[model samples]
Target: MEAANLCAIIAHVDRVSIGKRLAEARDAAGMTQDSVARAVGLERTAIVLLEKGDRNLKVPELVQIAQVLGRPLSYFVETPVPAAVSRRSAPSLAHASTRVLDIEIDQFALDVRALVRLGLLSGAERDARARVPRSHRAAEDAATSFRRRLGLDSQSPVLNLGRVCETAGLYTFAAALGESGPDGACIEVADDSGTVGAAVINGDAGSGRRRMTLAHELGHWLFGDAYDHGASRDSERMISSFAVHFLAPRAGVQKVWSENSNSPIRDRALAVGVEFQLSWSATVGQLMNLALISHAQHDDLKLREPRAGDYLRLGLSWVEELEAPYLSPGFMAACLTGYTEEKLTEARVLGLLRGRLDASQLPQIEARSLEDLRQAFMGHGG
Candidate 1:
């Protein structure tokens, strides 16, 4: 039979037999339904229902479950096993499906895989209190706390958001297209694209725009928002605000501005760089919140066109002719490598790594590779 037909057969067999067949498959493999549920974030009861043919299943969910069971979806279709048995340690399934690239791209898929792996490995069990703040003030307050946790001084200079994301253990990528979907997205191996770590930014945009997009996506990841491949403008605004506060805390910006009232807002923008809109807006908002700037000045500034040119010029000087780190090769390499290493090892052991590596593209490495591998194995590595 053709591979596709075989896969369909497997899926059909699993469904018709009321999960008894599935339970036997699990038993033969020595895996519990609970384990599969945990891996996919489904309820244990749902697994029982699935096995018993009592619940209808979506194609995607069915595919995922079949993958976890180490058979093609068609396997379930062809031969339904009885539900009485259980299994242990079923083979790991690919995390996502494969699709033709909707857009042409550059860069290694392995690196992409690595980034997804790192993101999963570094995934935070978000605190309930980490909800998005309502007002700008609340947002700023949260930013301050977060910055403190990172041991950053409020006034410390920041440029190149990709670097910031890398530091925070996020996997990010720049894409040439600006599709109608999200500025970027996080996905597991199970998504059709089968990418592990990726955040697509508008590659056509200037460096400044790319930085903003990176920060925006990182904000979603950090804030623990459910992954939405298509985020709305309002969601972008909220995530943008979160990024602003995350990068430039209110108190520090206020203190710096207070020390130098004559410091041109233009200069502050320059000092930070082109991606400073959110930071600048947040700073001005904080001043207004503290009753420093009048309502009129705030309104005027908000209405003003952003001085992107001015900020770029000033920011360039501060960096002593070195391009922003986000634009640097080292930063990109570190981010891609760090994320890939973290994810592949973690997700593989966790049974989350899916898909096959294109061995032809795998890189030759040094003895340090072993050291790095050991570090990740111990969970002490990035």
Candidate 2:
């Protein structure tokens, strides 16, 4: 393509991928072009130029921008660019390997939402209007009210925590949000690092670790919401506390322990793990938080942390065989509002799904059926 045409194509892709208006989605999604530019390793002006169809972009550059936008590469070229000149066919490009478990995690989040809407669970997104408090107590109160509004008992064990998060409008993804931050974050998935889920469990971690990581991130979403900008050890602890309370409420843990005084706290913890479908470490954390186990006991248990891989394996098995589909509310919202693959593809070429996924991949998937591409990408039986 000619230089001017290339620039126009780039601008058009940005408009579609990011939405009709780049400024609007960026503002609404709470992002700055500079931040996005930095994430994509481009000059700030380059972002502006690209957004305005004034910069000529190479395919590789387009791919980087798409990653920043939280979209696949197929998003950019499937329609406007003629099929004869397309870089690659949709199925071949879609077949590029991804972490299967990661895709499963994203799909799981989606299924969870489906379950909630089906009346299998109850929850809601944290109000975008609620005042985020600096005080710990205030944050807790806000979190409690959020729980109550979602019809979740303050002290009830969360039977399906992941499902609860999806019902709250988070887009769970397999990709980690980088190393500097916590295991995951709740930022605007597309506008930020393309992460939508409560947390991004490190793809490299064993399954059990991923599960804990997910719970940890879920704690953030439940308490911190999208307004909280950064992650910290203190914030992590507070969210951990929130996760414990949500999973094994103080009252509930006390009630269980009261019935098993003769049983060792470790044994009690194990039982709680089974009853609440939480990890044993999580159960122990609940005991420590509730003062049922002494600090020394808590420390001892911590010294003998259970293998996260074991827990992850069991959890995956359960999710696949017994648990219902975990759908994402965000995906549902996008689908319901007519944000189809074709639309996303248009955005990709224009640089809208710029920072989300590889722009090159967008065209491949956009030209192919999502189901066919999903099967090729994931090797999923269905």
Candidate 3:
């Protein structure tokens, strides 16, 4: 009788510990119980019961939750590595209607945090936000700074922003957003430690749009306020303004922008668009914003929008077709570092990559030597 009683007590304790860990993991991932329940195909009561230690957890349920939270199942059995979230953990999305994307964004940020906590991702070298001054010149100065750091002037086209962002201590990676998903989202891992941590840019967009989104997300990281009920008027303007100047600097635009009425404005927009690898509309809009052209002129340019063939006629290659999905080379390097050091297991590393990346992209992670078993024991014990 005593043995059975002791067994029951032990079971109860384990349940409670698992419950506490689940709650913490969800918090670290910045997801609410409702969001988690919805993601894992459970009722809200199920998540509540699991967290309160009032219900027994199924193995499948625990595994599902681990993947959804972007955590390892082992995390629940052991004391979890604490997540280092910015005091402001909410994401600053360029597209406001992104409730559909909350699950993936939270998971991505928390996963990166886990890797950083494990020392896989090295400490951030610098904070892009610190480089910008808090004045009227904020956007312009930030654009100049990024350009200078990227080894380019306004006259030079940004051939690849994914590589440039890595130089600024930002990890610009891609996450799959289904056809109807937001263009991009960014989460800056801020700690009291002052390391810029990391950021991911959604890359399921067209290649040109992907570059624009990376610059837009940079605006969010540099100057975005925490999740407001709605994007405040001033905040959205600044982000858009920053993206414009950063990706298509005013000086660079003037150098490449043609004002010849005889030459089709669509051709002009396409020319600049091809060079900067940005959306034609956005490129033209920046020109209008700089007062280089009138609003009416922009409208007229839109009328004869250049087709894909038009770009080929000018001997310009289709950049969008040529660019790969925007996964940060730096972040991928860290994952490899952790695996090489045996800090992460083969299954664990591949699992994390498979969850965040597409099948076609899986080969990159697969190519790594995850066979290292040296650090396999690192994850043992709470």
Candidate 4:
């Protein structure tokens, strides 16, 4: 009985410690108990009790909390709590209200890193990260540098921005973050040598928004030191400007808008969209930022959405494709590598792909004969 009592006492103490850590993590994440509860699908009292060690805590629930709070699972489950949790005085809270969408992005970055570390995702071609300079005109500098390095003229459309970013050593993925969530988010991963090991972006936004989101997220990575845990309005605007210029250079706008469409602002913006694959409003805003369009002219153009057949009428050819792999690049590449190396079973690969893609979209990989490769690569050497 005494031994059982001592064991009970130790268990009770552990619970108390977990409760304290939970409370601290919640505060640091700048979330209220209610918000955390809502995210974890628990009632407010449940969160309170869990934090106080009065309620049972499950592993999955704790993990969900860690994700919602942007705290690592290790932070909660690992021994020897961090100093921030152990200190007598409460550490200063981060931004009191971060968009939950950003928190989801944070989790996405973590998951990608984990997958890459586990060899479930390919890390090939990851060393080409840009050495971006910091300055007031950082966005402009980045835009110019990317164009020059990639041999892209201002008018050249980024036919595949997702592949472009991935080739540039940024791990890009898209997820349906819901309408209320942010269109995108970026996180920077690095090593002790100050090398950017990996960068991640959530570009689940629609085609137009996805392009802009990729630029904005890349801007955050190139200009800022690291991911901004507490991004402010000004910082958002700055990166937004970078995105605008990166996707639609001043010269490109002038060349496209001047050649065909020159009248009302809406018409000019729509014309830019047709040429650039950008949202109409963003194209107009970029023109305004570059002083190509005056405020009066911008105001005069009625802001409206694209009607049906707008792309066909405008000669935008890329829109006809039913689906593009913006969100599945990393996973797809990893699955391919695994299958080719015989590291993963075909059933596993198909099952995983089915989650991210339609069953019909999944491909069957068969070993190609040397003759087939020679014919494919050497054109039969005729």
> What are the candidates' C-alpha RMSDs?
14.6, 14.1, 7.8, 10.4
lDDT per prediction?
0.47, 0.48, 0.63, 0.58
TM-score, prediction 3: 0.69
Give a tens-digit lDDT track for model 4, residues 1-382.
0122333343445666677678877875678999999999999999999889898776667767866875555444434312212222334322122334343344445444444644665453322344333332776767877777777886666666766666555656565444344565555543222222232333344566667777776665565433333554466566677677777877888887787664655556677876677766787677777787788876654355667476557655435210222444755677666656656555445433434655455556679889878877787566
- lDDT per residue for candidate 3 within 89-142, as digits (tens), equals 435433543432444455555556667677766545544234223343677777
Per-residue lDDT for 1-382 in model 2, tens only?
Answer: 1233455565555444333233333343346889878887888897787666566666666666655654444334323212211212224321122232232233234333333433333444355454334454554565566577669775565544455666665545445423322343333222111233323344444333345555556655554433444444365556555554555555666776776678766666655665555655676766776667888898898777655464454342222211112223444334323324333223423332212435344434336778878887787564
Instruction: Sort the candidates on TM-score, descending order.
Output: 3, 4, 2, 1
Highest TM-score among the candidates is held by which one?
3
Query: What TM-score does each of the candidates earn?
Result: 0.46, 0.49, 0.69, 0.61
Q: Determine the backbone clash count of candidate 4.
A: 0
Q: Model 1 compared with the native: what TM-score?
A: 0.46
| Model 1 per-residue lDDT at 341 | 47
The count of residue-pair clashes in candidate 2 stands at: 53
